[model samples]
Target: MKRFEGKTVLVTGGAQGIGAAMAKAFAAAGAGVVIGDIGDAAGQAVQAEIAALGGESLYLHLDVSSEADWQAAIGLTLEHRGRLDVLVNNAGLGPAPAPIEQCTVQAWDRIMAVNARGVFLGTRHAIAPMRAGGGGSIVNVSSIAALGLGALMEVAYAASKGAVRTLTKVIAAQYAREGIRCNSVHPGPIDGGMLHGVWSDPTKLERRLSRIPMGRLGRMDEVVAAVMFLASDESSYTTGTELTIDGGAAVQ
Candidate 1:
């Protein structure tokens, strides 16, 4: 049987980028997939793509920062699939690079709401259902920024991710005995999508690339594979851990 033949996964911010990749991957692995994102059009497009691939999926309008949206999304998933086997807290915001001193309070709050608070809310709600069902896995998409390995700028983004990192550990420790597993994935300088906007300048892009010992930006599929492992039974023994997929950048 396929690894996830009887599973269901909900991927937040799944309309694009790594979140989209995770949604596709889970469906391909034989899970019923749910794509949650604020971008209705893009989210529907992803749902269509999964359908075309003969995968079962649904798209839900979700603003990760809102408690109502989280409740609704989870409610819909349980209504449709009966049980949620995995939750990917992949929604996040990467503000334009700015020094801490120059960062506005609004920008800081916005980042925290989406990046940090969103994870908290998702985890808070997902746990009860998971426990009732006997088990579940939560794969949180954090960042290399949380490790203090990002550019000198991005203070707010870094702080927000740091919250996600700690929160992952707390959830894992609190719920391990209940069969619920929680882990965080930290990726660095992923190519395309969000990074395209961050590294729009050729010189800046090259400078960023130079920092990675791999001499290139990481691929979305690479990160998706890590998330898939964490989500599957293959990682049954793993929890409360941080998996860094940074192309050796974090080491240097």
Candidate 2:
């Protein structure tokens, strides 16, 4: 049987990038997936692709920062998929790289709202259905920035992700007794999507690669596999921990 057969996964910011990738992977693994994102077109396209793959999925218009959106999204997930088995807090904001001094208040607030508060809201709302269903897993997509590796480039973004990292631990600890598992995945300069601009530039790309012992940026599938592990029964004993997928960047 497929790994996620009969399970339901809700992926936030699943319209594109790593979010879309995770949604497709979960559905292909046999989970009924909910693609939650503000980008309606891209989100629907991902849902369609999953359908073509013979996977079950639906797109939901969700602004992760909004509690109202979270309520509606979760409501729809239960109404359609029957139960919530996993919640992937994959939506986040990456502002242009700026030091703390240059990072405007507006940028900080916006980043925190989407990256930090959004994860908080998603986790908070998902707990009930997950508990009602007997158990669930929540995988928050943090960043190597949260570990101080990328802070020099984006202070606000790093701070926001730091919040995600700790928040994940809190959730894991409080919900373990209820059979809920919570973990965070920290990824370094991924090769495409949000980090494409960095990889697209020769100077920046070389600089990033030089910092990593692996000498290459991470891949989307690499991160996806890690998340799948955490969300699956394979990680039944794991909770309140972090898995870093940074190609040794954190060690350097």
Candidate 3:
């Protein structure tokens, strides 16, 4: 049987980038996938792509920062799939890099709401269903910024991801006996979406690339592979861990 033949997964911010890659990977692994994102059109497009590949999927409108949205999204998943086998808290935002002194209060709040609060709410609601279903895995998409790497100007973004990192560990420690597993994945300089804003300038892009020992940006598939491992039974013994897919940048 396929590894995830009887499983169901929900991936937030799944309309594009690494989240989208994860949705597709889980579906291909034989899981029913629910994709949540604020971009209705893009979300639906992903749903269609999955359908075309003979995968079952649902697209839901989700503003990850909102408690109501989290409740509704989880409800919809349970209603359709009966159980949630995995939850990928992949929804996050990286504001334009600005020094702490120049960052606005509003920007800070917005970043925290989506990057940090969203993970908290998603985890809060997922636990009960997961426990009810016997067990589940949560793979949070944090960033290299959380490790204090190359995030000098992104104070708020870095801090928000730090919250996610700690939150994953706490959840794992609290629920391990109950069969629930939680972990975080950190990627550096991925080639799309979030990285686009930071690497738009050719000079900056090259400069950033120079620091990675691998001498390149990470591919979405590389990160998705790590997430898939954490989500599957293959990682049954793993929890409360941070998996860095940063092309050796973290070592530097």
Clashes of 3: 0
lDDT of each: 0.91, 0.92, 0.93
lDDT comparing candidate 2 with the true structure = 0.92
State in Å the error of residue 95, model 1.
3.1
- Candidate 2 lDDT tens digits, 1-252: 999999999999999999999999999899999999999999999999999989999999999999999999999998998799999999998757766788888888999999999999999999999999999999999998888765355888888999999999999999999999999999988877787877788998887788899999899999999999999999999999999999998999
Clashing pairs in 3: none
Stretches off by above 4 angstroms in model 2 are none
Cα RMSD of predicted structure 2: 0.9
Model 3 error, position 209 (Å): 1.5
| Candidate 2 residue pairs in clash (backbone atoms < 3 Å) | none
Candidate 3, 202-227: lDDT as tens digits: 89888988889998989899999999
Deviation from native of the Cα of residue 64 in model 1, angstroms: 1.0
Q: What overall lDDT, based on C-alpha atoms, would model 1 receive against the true structure? A: 0.91
Residues 136-244, candidate 1: write the lDDT tens digits: 9999999888887655548899999999999999999999999999999999888876877757788988888888899888999999999999999999999999999
Error of 1 at 137 (Å): 0.3
Per-candidate alpha-carbon RMSD to the true structure: 1.1, 0.9, 1.1
